[model samples]
Target: MSPSGKPPRAVDIVRRGLLTRPWRSAVEAVRPPWSPQESQFTQACTRCGRCVEACPGGILQRGDGGYPAADFRHGGCTFCYACAGACPEGLFLPRDGRAWDIVATVTAGCLALQAVECRRCQESCADGAIIFRPVAGGLWQPQLNRSACSGCGGCVAGCPVSAIKMEHSHGRSLAGM
Candidate 1:
């Protein structure tokens, strides 16, 4: 509702500062394995850097606000639970629960989508989450099986074009290309 007594439209929400802007400057950071929801994690975490030092894969780093986040540029998560064990606070869930709801997403920049043959992403995916399907007149297209993806980020750093990204699985759809 507005002071003018007119019903608010979707655009009004954005224009009137009731909703956040849609654009993002960077992708959301991935937290360490077994981390609680972002707000809870931030509230509970002490930025002690124990989880980052304990990471055998060396993927954990001090991200924004000095909180630890996963940087999959070097390797994928092994789900070793070392980060969870090293946390001095209750910022993480039990290791028996799923780590997080993240999954790998392939963007339009994939080589195969441009008709250039490439299978690096598929090869790097140990969980066999990435598959290639043949087209009548085009090269095989990469298809991500969201259910099979372990969200390890194995394919992210290995991609030649940097097309892969980790996205929350809530409303994300499987690869259509």
Candidate 2:
């Protein structure tokens, strides 16, 4: 039984996989910058790979279900908006505005938090969102300035511990271009 207290739908079964595998992530894919909302983008994208081709960073790749997704391990987004320009379906938002509401999240496994000396993530962030502030016991703790963040995934790749991930800011709007 599902949390809704009803029989799971066929889509749910497929989403949960062959029962041997763990349940799939609800956020199945990370679309290109300026992309429309998830459900809309999935329904409208032609899977043409135009946006993926236009991405110079090479971070955008064919993700789950063949949809475009960003892999920050390759590199962070430069916000060139070339992906938006290449899309024929207008699936992406206008480029005249901010790109998206995504931002970096550092988990407990972060090296610095674990008392390990590491500044790779801070050095990688061009926006200076990741700042190491001195704390008790002469330890420097990494602090995130959410306002200074552009959700560019710049900090994700440099984390040697892989403690960083991009998540929604849940702001007033996600109409970033």
Question: Candidate 2 on 53-161: residue-level lDDT in tens?
Answer: 9999998998867788888878789999999889888888888777876888788899999999999989999999999999999999899999999888878878877
What candidate 2 gets wrong by more than 4 Å, as runs, is 1-23, 171-177
Question: The CA-based lDDT of model 2 is what?
Answer: 0.82
Write model 1 residue lDDT over 59-176, tens digit each, in one string.
Answer: 8989878888888787789999989888888678887767888899888998999999999999999999999999889669999999999888889878988888888898443211
Error of 2 at 74 (Å): 0.9
Q: Predicted candidate 2: what Cα RMSD to the true structure?
A: 8.1
TM-score of each prediction: 0.81, 0.82
Model 2 residue pairs with clashes: none
lDDT at 133, model 1: 97
Clashing pairs in 1: none
Candidate 1 local Cα displacement, residue 102, angstroms: 0.7
Over the full model, what C-alpha lDDT does candidate 1 score relative to the true structure? 0.82
Question: By summed lDDT, which 10 consecutive residues of candidate 2 come out lowest?
Answer: 168-177
